[model samples]
Target: MSGHPVLTMKDVGVCYFRKRGFLKRQKIWAVRNVSLDVRHGETLGVIGRNGVGKSTMLKVMAGIMNPDAGVITNYGGYSVSLLALQVGFLPYLTGRENVFLSGMLLGMTRTQIAEKMSEIISFSELDDAIDYPVATYSLGLKARLGFSISFHADPDVLLIDEVLGVGDAQFRVKSAAAMRSKIRSNKTVVLVSHNLETIEEMCERVVWIENGTTRAIGTTADVLRAYMSQVKGRAVPDPAD
Candidate 1:
């Protein structure tokens, strides 16, 4: 990894305001005091139970949402792309059109997307369905399209949220290989997944989050072992029982 970080988040927090009654509301913090850095060329895995704010952290890093506290520092003109299903797509548009649209949204120019169009289509394995409206596609199909476009967009930093398991078994294998290729080429990645094995296999470092807070951050094996130990500890029957 490079000496300088592409992205650095410091003590960031995000809260959602939900209506409670006729004249009251509640502020629920989805993530709090979270600090991390995306060094050049490193794949960082974020592993946690569901509803622990992993997705919220990714959204904040992608600039789709602002933190309610702390700050995020972008070193320079590094482009970051968030790979989440159906987040920036138009259901009325064809899968082919959405590829260009999503690619542009990820900071690729028209000509750049045009140059990569064929490869993106081939990678998605949509075949003739690429010309069909996105609304007609299944969830897995949308995920394939989204992953293909974003992966080919070649952003400096990529934020992925529990999306590597999308699509069929064959596509899953293909996508994993594609991600490893990007990493080999020194692309920065932040991946959030519940699958500890994948995290251990793909990440150099891992962060464990719990209750919207960072519980541990270290090498993949170290953090995974700690996280799994805690999970297993919780699973054991209480002595009082």
Candidate 2:
């Protein structure tokens, strides 16, 4: 699938310091044994419950956070990401400035960023608000702009968080379309979204994380069906027999 895998993870685990006792510092593992391969040109959907370390997985992929165990290999261009909602934006800066900042972080020259500025603005659909301070924009708008900037970077691997819920309905549609365009370009996309329908539609494969561990990894339809079945019976009240 486009030569070799663009991203590979094996026995990857993340741990954080919990407390420093008189004897030692206790650690907590947020995710464990997350070995996965992201072949180029494929979308890998990671779905999990809230606070289940989905964001931490993406961070590991992006090299923002290092793992306590296991190895991660990447044989592609740099991993540019919009890992969290509005993560890369500076509130005091205008949307336009953030685009350049993003490009710089992605290792682009100033001229290169300028070349794609118009495209990002159009894709984000923030024409009127582009020059305004980002803090003035809504959460959805922030997500849209952040995504547009990273999308235009044309990275080999793109890690997107749940920011797809940003923007108005029409803008959301546009963002989804842009996402499809990225997939068609054969870029490796690692998407973390709570919208199960979007996951089913966009992902070629799904990895279901449960309790900070990979409980299932397979076809989207199969995983979703099993996950829903497990979730459905849990919330139902017992009938008065």
Candidate 3:
């Protein structure tokens, strides 16, 4: 991968306000003092415990949410997309209609979506269900549609948040293969996953978040070693083992 940074976050912070009675509000910092750079054509992994602001940071990176403090710089004005299982599909809309809706939301032109419509539906294996209302579809069906839409969107920067385990086993294999192909093609990706094996296999580098802050950032092997050591409270295991 090139050393050129495509995206950079400097001391970024995000906070949320929650109602605490009639006139009081509580402030909760989701991300605090996070600094990192994503190089061009690199798959960066983000690993952290639950509720640690990893998802919030990704939203910031995707420009879905602005940071409360610090700055995020995007070089070359690249388009970024986030792929999560719970896509914002209008429940009452048909799967086909939602495909157009979600595809455009992912930065695909309407014409482009039309060109790829058949392929997306075919890949999703929704078949006749493609015409059914998304509200009537099962969770797996929704995931399939979401994955298919995002996969075909082909954004410059792909931000994935635990969407790999979607659908059935066969679909999981297919999705993983597609993601690997994208990564092999030098597409830039930022993956947030709890599956350490997936991170170790796909990511060249990783950023570890703890308590809404960056705890470690380095080569996959090194950072994972430290993270595992701390989590296990024991000496790190040999990779060969």
lDDT of each: 0.84, 0.78, 0.91
Mind giving the per-residue lDDT tens digits that candidate 2 earns over 1-241? 4446778888899998876867788879998988778877788888878998899988888888899999999774655564344546788998888878767776568998899999988887889799999989987788787777777777668888886655788877877787777776777788898999889888888887877777777777777776777677643221211
**lDDT of each residue in 86-203, candidate 1, tens digit only:** 5579999999889888888888899999999999999989999999999999988998988898888877898888777678899998998887777667678898888778788788
Candidates 1 and 3: which is better by TM-score?
3
Tell me the spans in candidate 3 whose CA falls farther than 4 Å from its real position.
234-241
| Model 1 residue-pair collision total | 0
**Cα misplacement distance, residue 159 of candidate 3 (Å):** 0.7
The residue-level lDDT of candidate 3 at 52 comes to 97
- RMSD to the native, candidate 1? 4.2
**TM-score per candidate, in order?**
0.90, 0.83, 0.93
Candidate 3 structure quality by residue, lDDT tens digits, 152-201: 88999999998887899999999989888887789999999999999999
